[model samples]
Target: MVEVAMSNCANARPTRCIGVRVLGVSKSIKGNPVLDTVSADFALGRVSGIRGHNGSGKTMLLRAIAGLISVDKGSIEVFGEEVGVDGSFPMGVGFMIEPLELWDEFTGLEMLTLLSSLRGKFCVDHLRSTLIRVGLDPNDTRKIKSFSLGMRQRLNLAQALMGNPRLLLLDEPTNALDEDGQETICRILRDERDRGTTIIVVSHDREQLDRIADVQYVMSDGRIREV
Candidate 1:
């Protein structure tokens, strides 16, 4: 039987070190379990990596943390605040998942502009620099539909990194990148970690995970074990 915990943040208080805590989290889709009693603590100002093969519940875990999905059991707390209690995601969290759907009619710059405007944090120059940092040509006015796979991936990353989110979640962030592109992203993530950002990354690339993750976990058979 699945266990469920009522969300409560009445006593939530900022922790000096911990950024997120997952306690007995479990989820199922259409009666098939994906996450089974998963629990982990993510330290503040560090990168945590989840490595698993396809269908091992990595993405589901991330989506649950992002407040994009409801877990059938357990609790998720971000920065000491309960996730479901408020029906709103924690502030300054950014995520990039697979199957990205962009405004094909808008230019890459335009899309980023729209996102940053919603955040109300970055200016146009900052947005342009973010695009350039992700290896996209900010001056290019071509529509997103004209972009190649790798270009689109870079743009996806740009949006996630636009506002310098306090917590960043990325799944297969280097999916279509070449060696140089992958290295660039690693450097950027490392920089963000140094600046006190908490990041969670899900990837199949063991080497990349080892290089960037302060701590790592392997998910299998709907469970996660620290490595």
Candidate 2:
């Protein structure tokens, strides 16, 4: 366990060794501001947790960082490369947003194979390993359509972590998991950190975040601050 002092600490690391940087980022959706001049440095090989109320711009920030959406102003950098510099999708990132979706017709392994194929990378061994890591059976042939809510969430996370992603952006990763499953996710995240991956996780579960996060931040009304 990371054992972070969640209620009152947000560790600020030096910029030189950072993994991701959000600089003066602002976004307005149909004239309503979503992100306003937000800036922060996410350290390399560390887990940072973000907590906020609904519609607080937490998801938007992750989208921008993932290059799924562009910010109207400012920029995001991953490992020193600008996120939208070439108008191309950001590379080396894995993320799970709200309202997780999965292919109900395919088995767990099949779904992972398809998702990885879309990225032009697939390894059956790796995919199977990922499924097992998330407490799922690689040998099970049950299509995802028949899986429980918790199972789907685990598969969702497995995809995000299957590859060698330099950065990970996860939203409510433990949303539908049980107590043991939640603990499993936390341990996996810490293991990822130890493997030198930078993680930015957004969750409302303060206790959960406290266990895995090295530092924490709080967001409100399109603004973010260390806590």
Candidate 3:
């Protein structure tokens, strides 16, 4: 269980520090308007959770922030840098979206190594510790294709947490976990906020979000409102 109450937790921080900002953002995919002038501010050094039904544009909002896809209108600013204009992807960002795609031939360690190599190298021990944090066995060498769904989810989380990224974007982070696994992940995410990391999470689990989110939002019909 999430035993740390928000008041008692060591998460004190300034209220005015904004990490990510979206303004009048609109997008259409294949003639479907997925994001309809959505806008919100995610506070720095906290976990911001967005709850929405499937295809409500929560994922699309994240993609716009991450520079994965360009939006048709409005601006997304991360740490005062405009996304898609300042750079393709914001610096020091780690994200794990759905579909959990990876090279089936590569082991967990190998896959993380390959991904991490893109930015730079992380110590082997660091990666190993990240794996352990995500409830994965650091010594496991099984290929990704052989991993169970829960295992794959854990791996995806491990990669997102690999470098102690300044910003973390996670979609349904605890998707395939058991009760214990879900608790561990929530604890990790809660602890990340303590470390001054900015996080934006999209989940269907309102209860689980309550455990970790410092602030919550509801999304409907491609619009967002604070909860």
Candidate 4:
């Protein structure tokens, strides 16, 4: 039987240090700029919110920091180490992108199991705790093909939280969640920050960001300014 923790999991990071630092990063596609000359610093033990109107390059910026997109200019560093064009952010960083695609044929547990196996890391108990954290039912062996949007969103979050990521890059994490689900995610993020993980949440949910973020960034037309 899978053991689901009745409460939230403990924080993985217990020490304070700088987490993510971005410097003059820029990215463009098809000669059109999405993010231009962006720079920021995400400190340890804080939940930083990135907010912008539609088409403001908020998601693009997060993806750049996560090493998902190639920067046309500038650099990104996590814990003082440079993250190059290749999608590498050391071993401790984790990221969740938009569209949260998962293998429909695989059950949630199966998906996580496969991912963990890819890294030769076995932690069934950790996987179960993460599933529980996102309000997923570990015992439900149903494949992801049958999961609702909200269920898929939760599962995406669970996968990102696997292996106790030190720097979490989230894009619209609360998009498909209900009020309770949103609250739970906020709680988890706060708990992680308290434990010394730096978080960068990109979302349009102003109310939620206001409640959880220590500071907020407003991105518009590929430019960023602290709000």
Displacement of residue 205 (Cα, Å) in model 1 is 1.1
| Of candidates 4 and 2, the better by TM-score | 2
Write one digit per residue (lDDT tens) for candidate 4, span 1-227. Answer: 00121122133342124577778988889989998898887766578999999989998887777777678899888777777635565567767878766999999999999988876575899899899988998989899999988899899999889988878989999888899889889999988876777789999889989989988999999999898
Query: Which lDDT tens digits does candidate 1 get at residues 1-227?
Result: 00111012223443546788899999999999999999988877789999999999999999999899988999999888888775888778988976678999999989988877778758989999999899999999899999988899999999989788889999999998999889989998988887778899999999999899989999997899999
Clashing pairs in 3: none
**Over the stretch 119-208, how does candidate 3's per-residue lDDT look in tens digits?**
679988888899889888878878899998888899999998988998999999988899988988989998888888889999999998
Best by TM-score: 2
* Stretches of model 4 off by over 4 angstroms after superposition: 1-17, 85-87
Model 2 over residues 48-111: C-alpha lDDT tens digits? Answer: 9999999999999999999988899998989888998778777889889766577788999988
lDDT of each: 0.87, 0.87, 0.87, 0.82
Q: Lowest summed-lDDT stretch of 10 residues in model 4? A: 1-10
Candidate 3 ranges beyond 4 A from true positions: 1-16
Indicate whether candidate 2 or candidate 3 has the larger TM-score: 2
What's model 3's TM-score? 0.91
Residue 108, candidate 3: Cα error in Å is 0.9
Clash count, candidate 3: 0
Q: Name the better of 1 and 4 by lDDT.
A: 1
